[model samples]
Target: MKPIELMRAEAVNLTEDPDEVCGYWRGHLVWVKQEDADGLWYVRVNHPDGGYLYDGFWRAHRDCTAADAVAEAFRGAELLEDE
Candidate 1:
């Protein structure tokens, strides 16, 4: 079994929308707004051809760590998104 790998990145709160600041993660396609609070976070993976592939959105709370929540959310949402 291979361990799951995640690419973590951060962005500022230009607005209240997580997708706006993290828009770069979606290759500027505008990722779906997952959650917005203090800062913005996004997940983008490289495609087979080296292009960016938008995974989804992640909502972070001030009380919790965004990285952990984002990773867990992505892992859980991966299968649902594929279906």
Candidate 2:
């Protein structure tokens, strides 16, 4: 498999770039990488207030379901005006 970094770059070139996608994360449409990197995935949430959070890819995931859960949780959060 290709490195996650390279994979992300390739995704950007695709018509529907999954890496460059925005999903629900804490009441906001956040940009996230919905795939594993180095045997793990992340929950890098983008805050609508111009700030963001990404903690060492600690929120590891062995499948997309986990990542989708994050999105679900975010969707459940109260929608923000800015988002």
Candidate 3:
């Protein structure tokens, strides 16, 4: 998607699972999961262009909300565009 299109795109959830959630935001894939041990959220963002921000791995958001995690992924996507 074009940068402008991406910037305007809203996140779309792909699953209804309670423990895990997957969505797409501005052409980036975002996955958020709650850890069974600590109940913290794990967020991962994957861009189609493949950037250093995510590298196809999950990052602990540590007490962050699902919306915050999604926002974080969108921020990562924006940063990747700056590169």
Candidate 4:
């Protein structure tokens, strides 16, 4: 799959955490949040219908910004987005 630019909803946070961010990328709803135990970042991409599109833990360190985490998720889940 080819890479595409990501567009984020700056004021959106699908989860309860206000610090986390959520937006749609390539028709999938992408959300980035930090892990409580490991302090790593993880992302969840849901389809337009709210079905699970992709869910994975990014290799980002605790200091990684939300934008970077979301970008990693988008890049890692490119192939899954096609289905």
For residues 1-83, could you state the per-residue lDDT of candidate 2 as single tens digits? 22233223433322224433444433433444545543344444445575554323434344544435344324433233235
Instruction: For each of the candidates, give the backbone clash count.
Output: 0, 0, 0, 0
Q: Best candidate per lDDT, number?
A: 4
Stretches > 4 Å off in candidate 3: 1-9, 16-18, 55-64, 75-83
Q: Each prediction's Cα lDDT score?
A: 0.37, 0.39, 0.54, 0.60
By lDDT rank, best first, the candidates go: 4, 3, 2, 1
**Shift of residue 20 alpha carbon in model 2, Å:** 7.3
lDDT assessment of candidate 4: 0.60
Give the total clashing residue pairs for model 4.
Answer: 0
Task: Evaluate model 1: give its lDDT.
Answer: 0.37
Q: Indicate the residue-level lDDT of 65 in model 4.
A: 68
List of clashing residue pairs for candidate 3: none
Q: What is the TM-score of each candidate against the true structure?
A: 0.30, 0.34, 0.49, 0.58
TM-score of candidate 3 against the unseen true structure? 0.49
lDDT of 1 at 69: 44
Residue-wise lDDT of candidate 3 within 1-83, one digit each (tens)? 53223433555656535556576665666676666545465656676575434533335445654555555555654545455
- 1-83, model 1: which lDDT tens digit per residue? 11122222332221223233222222222223335565344544434355544464454565544334444434543522543
By TM-score, rank the candidates, best first.
4, 3, 2, 1
